[model samples]
Target chain A: MYQNPRAMPSAFQPVPALAIPQGDREGALLVAYANGDPEAAREIMAALAPRVLAQALRMLADRAEAEDVTQDAFLRLWRIAPEWRQGEAKVSTWLHRVTANLCTDRLRRRRRSVGLDEVAEPEDPAPSVAARMQGEARLRALSDALAQLPERQAQAVSLRHLEGLSNPEIAAVMEIGVEAVESLTARGKRALAALLRGRKAELGYDED
Target chain B: MTRIETGADGGRELDDLLAEARALEVVPSAALWARLAADAERERPRPRTVVPAVPPAPGGWRGWLRLLGGWPAVGGFVAATLAGIWIGAAPPTGVSSVLPSLWGEDVSVALGVDEDPLSLLEG
Candidate 1:
């Protein structure tokens, strides 16, 4: 018999992982596009758009602008497909770098007009309505905590933690030394924990 | 609920919190994909034109020779002129008959050897 130490209660089941396709598909499409196939470019853009947009949304905190940044990133990818050298870096990472740069620029431009408190919480009102409701408060608290960090710290934390990139990979994307990346993420995590500690109840961390 | 000691220390708690936060998923709108596709299509560089091959000239051999020699017609003219000049040059008389008497006259002028250079070739 299996010893289930942390079995989910009847009221609470774990959510399944999101099905994001592998990067190989996008790489193939990019190669096809380089070989003068426009349809391949379209396919790659369609596949990558969502992930790029999500990262942008997390970084910029404005859905509309995130969408714009995502589009711009894909556009650059399409234009550069012909010049793309294989085995240099993953296409996804390149796209991430482009999105990050655009978000950074947008953040700089909006610094005067917007405050960190104004970043709207990300929402998805599907699946179990109860889960959706539970996610809102946690998301808001986390977003606020994320907003409070310095720009580089926020970016390092976002790329490493949220985006699930390795520290070295993040360092490459951020064009920084790995040691600097570690320092940023370490500091960013400390700041995040302090920010989120008060809201532990809402985030399901303090539940019995 | 049994609280298992993960031994992650205080930093572990923060890591766990960050992990949970990262697990939150937000799928981008379908419209965003459509817009991205459109933008990609627009930004994609047009395929470069495949240049058609230039057909070799009507006289293939002549064309090849012309290409090989850079200036085929000029090369041909110079070659023909050299050939004509070589053909017009007079052939030499028999070496023995021409050079033996010349050698005898040179010996009489100076105390040279009696046997001529051309006479050495005779049997």
Candidate 2:
């Protein structure tokens, strides 16, 4: 659905979001929410959900599971609005942490029944439409490899390489030091290379 | 059999894979948004609905009396009460004669240790 960012009514008028840069959008939306602009919630829901949902999908490897994690994370952002100490942390970093923690919780629960099973192979049969997308195959392979990495390493890799978060931002989301974030991502990248090396030929990595 | 390209080795190939993942955008379905909107509405504290205090419509006797303010009305009220007490406590001869009947003869007897009606007559 096309949500006209302005079509969403606001309880109080806000400075328009037209000039908001990518990094500052969530913060702007949050400030609007705190100031009682109703539209801010909708804008935040639209802007952040896709990113959060995508991250959750990568972390959890299930669409339903990812969507649940996204919902919970946004619900929490709403709940914490009044006391959201602005500038203490970027809203995106804070949300990434929440979604990560939630995914970790579900991962733990699923682990009770699922032992050492490789999580990368897509459980769903490739629909003809999706099968045409080579990127989807690469993502599936990468996700399976990620599942094999240690939890923190997987998270570090997802945040750094996949999510494109900087090391410091990854540290904030993982609640660890920047050095640790660096170490984890480095280790994760090495591990992924070793895993994917054997499959590159099969997955058409050199179609050219 | 196909081989994935890396600038150098496997590490470069993984980097290319990571780039694909980064560029990948997964927009959530509208139903998910609807669910969130419902939860947001359910969870949002209702706006306090401040019943705008109709500014008391400018005085029913007591308010006008209050707006008239401190000294004049309040002081007059206090002074009148004090005067009434003083008159009741110690009335002059002619005033005392009429007051006893207004108060009833029992009030003089009731004044007891605080007053002696006979002593006032001597004054």
Candidate 3:
């Protein structure tokens, strides 16, 4: 269904390929690192760490935890450098998958320990307090709704909608077929819409 | 890219909120970068330095030294050869008296040969 980018709206268009390092480059860098090249290690980290951390932050909504997840993901990358098979997956996709799993584990633990209401809102560095509060509320609400989703659905929707990845890219990250990705994202969006519609007033959306 | 499916109620609002979330770029803090770099450095594989148990033996005749138990054994062999040469060149008086008797023993008698092998060739 997602094979044709032209058929989709511009907003659903694929992210610019140049924005991310190609899988081949990442794979080569990892091989270089395995061969004891420090520059390769630095280059790979510079290319991938921020995105990995951002994905973690989007899922966890906590910077400290996000940083931890990012670090853990990179450490795994470092350990896997020698064994990483190129062409199998993009480094970003692998890292995102790892980050998602880590975030899901933490979210599950947090749920067991504390109530969703007790989950702290993210601190946004917006220019004004009102904007910052609004940003925080939106993130907090989205995170809460996402937490309510099944793990795969949350990951698929986040990768598709928030990260702006193509269906094929989401398929690679989630290790599922494109049809499964479409099914999950569609169901996830419907659930998110339902959850958010109920909170339309609380989230400061105009009641039409 | 904001694709709000207007087909669903409040889809536009959801799309807007998601667009805003996407815009909420979480630039990794400098500290996070430092931490990652540190992790990369700490976890990088280092080249191994292999040290030989014995210093490499030199080549040619010197290479033979390894087979003959190295330089020390060669030195000992050289010393023994020189000692033999010196002893042969200048025997002690007591050794000279016994030298003739030592040489007097017939090779044919020693081997219990009835006749010399060279004498057979002559016949």
Candidate 4:
């Protein structure tokens, strides 16, 4: 199992060795994969699959759907390899764009399958008294707040804050201008803050 | 007291909320990764060497045409048609080019002109 360097609790951790190289990594992998190197394709997939899945889950709010979308995205990457232009954009950003487009398609199909009103909320587990008295309430509050956002706003917020992508990067992934990404994230944050404010007492958070 | 000060406080609160949200752990299951890898592998292209076309029977006109034309002939036809349309639609130049003179001496009866139009052209 690969350990995530970002998951470490320490303030300082050595950067991951498998972290993608800046200059030639995207071009080399794309060229090799296009030339029918399965190993090169697998390496790129391994590095990117986790974050892509995470982004899908945040968008779809369903583990099964997220897995399907991630698979579809990678499958598209394989098919599109021959047409890839070197240095047009970062490979990671291109994959993110593919994943987002897949998620959008999935959302559209889901809307047809089940009406928005009938879309089920994930069942919340009962919190123990001790857990509720601690940080669990805050976590639950935050999750609920996130669930309330409109789809694009939630996606922009998750990509920017949770995934740590810059505005330009998020714009590339979302297929929009940087200014639009900034607007979506800003509005998402404001809405989240408003939603969480009334539940501060329940969350056991100190007043500002 | 000022609009900028109020906006700064809002921004700080937003940052705090976002930081809290980011702390939540949400890793996808291992089985999901396995499925993705399998799908990617299935979609990977198989490389094949390009093979030369087999020659047709010695007496056929089809074989002769194929040898002469190939893809280049088809490409040339498309290029010529596009070029012809592009040139045909371009605007005509100079006033006289579009409106030809019908007032020449032999052509004067056609327009019922009494004298040469060039005589009127001497301003």
Best by DockQ: 3
Task: Residues A1-208, candidate 4: write the lDDT tens digits.
Answer: 4344235343221223245366657556766667665566656766777778877765565667778888788787778888888777777887777776676666656655654334233345456755533444344444445556776876777677766788877888888899999899888877867766654445555556
Q: Write one digit per residue (lDDT tens) for candidate 2, span A52-153.
A: 999888766577888999999988988898787767778878888888778767766665645433434434556774454555656666766766677788
- CAPRI verdict on model 4? incorrect
For each prediction, how big is the interface RMSD? 9.1, 6.5, 7.0, 6.5
- Lowest-sum lDDT 10-residue window in model 2 chain B: B1-10
Candidate 3, residues A1-208, lDDT tens digits: the string is 1122223243211223234355478777777677676767666776787688788877776779889999899999999987888677777778878988888887777667766556454455556886667667777778777787788888887887778888888888889999999899899888878877866766768887
- After the best TM-score superposition of candidate 1, give how far the Cα of residue A207 lies from its true spot, in angstroms: 11
Ranked by TM-score from best down, the candidates are 3, 2, 1, 4
How does candidate 4 score on lDDT? 0.63
The DockQ-based order of candidates, best leading, equals 3, 2, 1, 4
List the candidate 4 regions with Cα displacement exceeding 4 Å.
A1-21, A58-62, A101-151, A201-208, B1-17, B24-28, B50-123
Could you give candidate 2's per-residue lDDT for residues B45-110 as a string of tens digits? Answer: 444456865445465877766666745878888999999898878877989788668876763255
Q: Which pairs of residues collide in candidate 3?
A: A11-B1
When 3 and 4 are scored with DockQ, the better candidate is 3
Runs with alpha carbons beyond 4 Å of true place in candidate 2: A11-25, A31-36, A109-112, A115-138, A194-208, B1-13, B52-123
Tens digits of per-residue lDDT for model 3, B1-123: 235343454387788777666666766777877787788888878755588988887889877879799888989999999988987999879787897788874453446564656876675
Q: Candidate 3's error at B43, in angstroms? A: 1.2
What value does the lDDT take at residue B65 in candidate 3? 75
In candidate 3 chain B, where is summed lDDT lowest over 10 consecutive residues?
B1-10
The DockQ figures for the candidates are: 0.17, 0.24, 0.31, 0.15
Question: Superposing every Cα of model 2 onto the true structure, what RMSD results?
Answer: 10.0
